[model samples]
Target: MKTAYTAALSMLAGIAVGAVAIEGLHAQSTPKAYVVSEIEVIDQGAQNAYLPKVTELIKSSGGTFLARGGNIFAVEGEAPKRVTIAVYDSFAKAQAARTSPEWKALAPERNKAIKVRSFITEGLPN
Candidate 1:
C-alpha cells in the first residue's frame, strides 16, 4: 500500500511540473507589436539623408525591420508610396523607440523630406 501511495505522489508532482513548463512556454510565445509607417517622400534627396539616421536609432532601440520601402498594391483605397514596418518586443517598446530622444532629433529632417503616418499594431502569435 505504501509503495502505491509513493508512486501516485510522484505522478502528481510530475504533472504539476509539466503544467508549469507549458505556462512558461505560452508566456514566451506572447505576440509582439509592429510599428508600421507609411511614408510619402516629397524630396528624395532630403529623405535619403534622413533615412540612415532614423534607421540607426531604431536599431539602437532594439527594433528589427520586418519590411522597408516595399511596393504596396492597394485594392480598396489610394496606395501609399512607401511602407516601413519595424517589429519590437512589445507595444510599449515600439512607442518608446519612436519617442526616444535620438529618434525625435531626426524627426524634423524626416518630416521635411516625407509625410509619414505611423501606428503600432499587435503582431500574430508565433
Candidate 2:
C-alpha cells in the first residue's frame, strides 16, 4: 500500500510540474513586426548624420535594421530615388519603443534632417 501511494504521488507531482511549465511559456510576451520607410531629403550632404542615429534607434527598440540602403531598380516611369526599409517586432512594441531614451535622442535628426514614414504591419501568423 505504501509503494502504491508513493507512485501515485510521483505521478501527481509530474503533472503539476508540466502544467506550470506550459503556463509559463504561454505567459511569455511575443514580439510583432513594424515597418519603416525613410526618404532622403533634397539636400543629401546635410542629411547624412540622421542615418546612423536612426540605426541606433532601431537597435534600442528591441530590433535592428533589416534594410539600410535600398536601391531603385526599375521605377516603371518614376524618378530615381533612394529609400530604406526597416522592420520591428510589433506595432505597439515599436510605438512604445519610439519613446525610448535612445529614440528620443534620434528623433530630432529625423524630423529636420530627413523625412521618414512608418507604420506597423502584421507579420506572418505563427
Winning model by lDDT: 1
Per-residue lDDT of candidate 2, residues 1-126 (tens digit)? 999999999999999999999976654544456565646575565577766666666776666667656566764765335555556656566767766677777666667776666565656634
lDDT of 1 by residue, 2-121 (tens): 999999999999999999999989767877889988889999999889888888888989899999986689999998899999999877788888888888888789879999999999
TM-scores for candidates 1 onward, in order:
0.75, 0.61
Off by over 4 Å in 2: 1-31, 73-80, 99-105
> RMSD, each candidate, Å?
5.3, 4.8
Residue 101 in model 1: shift from native, Å? 1.4
lDDT, candidate 1, equals 0.88
Return the number of clashes found in candidate 2: 4
Per-model lDDT: 0.88, 0.66
Output candidate 1 Cα RMSD. Answer: 5.3
